[model samples]
Target: MTNFDKILEVAQKRQGQSQPLKLQDSTVLLEQIKNREQDTRPLNLKHIESLAESIAVLGLIEPLVLDNKARLLAGGHRLAAIQLLKEQQADKYLHHFPDNRIPIRMLPFDAESEPDLALQVEIAENEQRRDYTPNEVKAIAERLRTAGFIDVKGRPKKGQKPLMPALAVVIGKNLRTVQRYLEPNQNTEQEKSTTPVVLLKQASTKLKQWQKIEPKTPQEKALAKRLPELLNLIEDVLSNEK
Candidate 1:
């Protein structure tokens, strides 16, 4: 049997269950995998760094998802973070990941032939998730602090780093946002700003940044024309805030 066939057999045996595989062993298989282009989301460097930090603290809690053919269906950011950790030779995290092995969960579908299924999995993995509430996160941080993971000021104790940033990574939230949640007295104004309001503020910032650039391409010109209306609508909605 060929190498691919052997890998497939092993993956089939462990289907739906996570199994550790060495990074070096998967190097050739990584090249053969398909459907990577289907993931259109841009990689966030900060998120990757955050993942690396959390992985170092807690190890890999969620395994990377792969299809029957070893095609990555989700956890692209996680894979990148593991690669970063390996490259940095993070010795402190070595015990958690022996021999550079990472856990992977192989699905029972071929991503190349079942493109729609692959897309659905990708969307569900990335979007169909709820974040921890502010109070819930605060409780977790407090527990860690009480356990001596961090000092009273939330700074690292011994070699253990502040759990706030790591918790932010685990919950997929902004570090500053998580820190605010841990505050003894959270600002009422900030509490009033819901997820949609925060998203709109981010969009407004991006649009204003775009306004500073001169539109040269046809697409850019079209977007530039619509920018004013979009900005006006955002301002109108924000102004109506209670």
Candidate 2:
């Protein structure tokens, strides 16, 4: 079993709830879960848009999971997508929010008594998410290091170990991969500084190529549409750098 599954098993055992509990209110508004965004994962607009479109047609299959206080334990991105879909379809002839009510499984642990368990829940949820960008992996590793999580032997753990292996296990990456992401750039201080002239020239050439592509996918089409706006933003950044 995955670490997440193991942690979840432990949590279920502790709470004495073998079965999932549904949120009591049938008409619980999406606004109830709104304004709570302490999740670690950054919102990916493309992902959200795609998911929202899918859920609009098919409906939510997996119910959201939430802590006892109604704070979201998982499904922050899904919630955001639901909100997006609601707004987009507000003017549609037969549209309503994805459902008349959202379903959620309640987490039995009290946040104050089992704070560590609560954090484990968050970690478990994010573990099943999309692969982190290299930069994101780096930030995660740094955060883990800052939090003083190291192997029992005082070095990076071997193979696919848990908490001790830190981000590697959490993100399902190898120890070497995690270490590589954590490694400092070899670039010198002078080499690290970038000039917008360099960036502008690169952006200009890429923009030319991207402008030529017959975008087939929604993502490609979005990129094609945004390329000009991106160039303009680059120009602003370049001007500001001056």
Candidate 3:
């Protein structure tokens, strides 16, 4: 089973009731978070617009998951889309909030800490279904590392902490992969000063991956030739550090 499946299985086993719980917005949930609720995934305007349009037309088919207090543990953009849809439809509709109240499937974090549980819930959700991006994973990894979490072997670095196992699962990568971003050179003695080396390696690997072209094919050859320049340009633009 996928790592995500494992998490759901755990949840299902621990479930107080077979059916999921539901709550009203007026319900007071505990608030222990220090981080602002924003899209760490960085949704583009085009995507947001598309989502808003889709939600407005079809309604949000799935409810966003939340930690008891209605603090979003996930589905930032989706909630935004739903909000946008309701806002535009509000005049034609109701008093408080419009469309279907944006349905949700609650999975409360019984863990001690909000930060850890939030990351855990996010990871489990990602693993259970799908909605994680590499950038988002990287950002989470950076946060965990900053909080002094250590890798499996306990190697450490500045601005790099170990990700809790659950979040790594949602990323669909191993703890090591998460740690690679956390500390790309954690144990490497010879190459400690390599800046963005992991990114460089990923870029190189991507470029080399495009070399699998059929020489007899016209389009393949053209694509292959452009790969190097494409990689260079992308790297240059991305690495500007502006």
Candidate 4:
């Protein structure tokens, strides 16, 4: 069958015991979604906006499947995107029907537990998506820990990294990076900052020197710190300092 058909079939199967759809004000639903347990990687605004625009134009092509208890079994961001589209409520043209929240589509979930189902959605969405930065992957890893028995060690106690190797592979980085990000005090224990919260205060005086450069992503931001080439680049770029 077609992709839409496949998505519908999947939605129907997921919401087996629940009703076909509900246009309930899903704000509470979403808040519960945030608190309940699930994962989302660091998203560059560019990508989310693109997806939002597509939903804005095409309508929510896929229905968000909710559990028997009204918990989301899948389509977390898809629902978020749809809500944003409805809020924007711009007069964009789709195949037709287009007046905001628009009763898009919903399917009930007959899942066993919220975490069990949420994890399935998390993996499904992640498998079909792009790579994330070390920082972003850490976010996902953190969520998985709290997302229920998905962990062999039971729920992680927060700020803990998985001892498992397979998870590291999914985030597209080695396990060490995962640990480094999850380390509880990393942000507060900035060794560089403590020696001086504001280093080379005078060095930053040359606004133009810093203004022209940008670190591409977390990796680039990091490599710039540890890479010798970047040290040379920094020296060259900041040469204008008085």
lDDT of each: 0.67, 0.61, 0.52, 0.47
Q: Kindly indicate the candidate among 1 and 4 with the higher lDDT.
A: 1
Which prediction has more favorable TM-score, 2 or 4?
Answer: 2
TM-score of predicted model 4? 0.32
Residue range 5-92, candidate 3, lDDT tens digits = 4544555556655854333333221222212355446755544544554444334434566665456766665666655655676642
Alpha-carbon deviation at 206 in model 1, angstroms: 44
Instruction: Provide the TM-score for each candidate, comma-separated.
Output: 0.49, 0.41, 0.37, 0.32
| Residue 46 error, candidate 3, Å | 1.9
lDDT for each residue of candidate 1 in 119-229, tens digit (9 for 90 to 100)? 666676666445666677766666555644453364556666566666777776777777777676664545666667787998999989989999999999999999999
lDDT of 3: 0.52
lDDT tens digits, residue span 33-133, model 4 = 32224446543444444445554433444455554465555565565555455456545422223322233223244444435544555456445544454
Kindly give the number of clashing pairs for every candidate: 0, 0, 5, 2
Q: After superposition, how far is residue 242 of candidate 3 from its true place, in Å?
A: 68
Q: Relative to the unseen true structure, what is the C-alpha lDDT of residue 231 in candidate 1, on a scale of 0 to 100?
A: 98
- Top-lDDT structure, candidate number: 1
Give me the overall lDDT of model 2. 0.61
Candidate 3 lowest-lDDT run of ten: 27-36
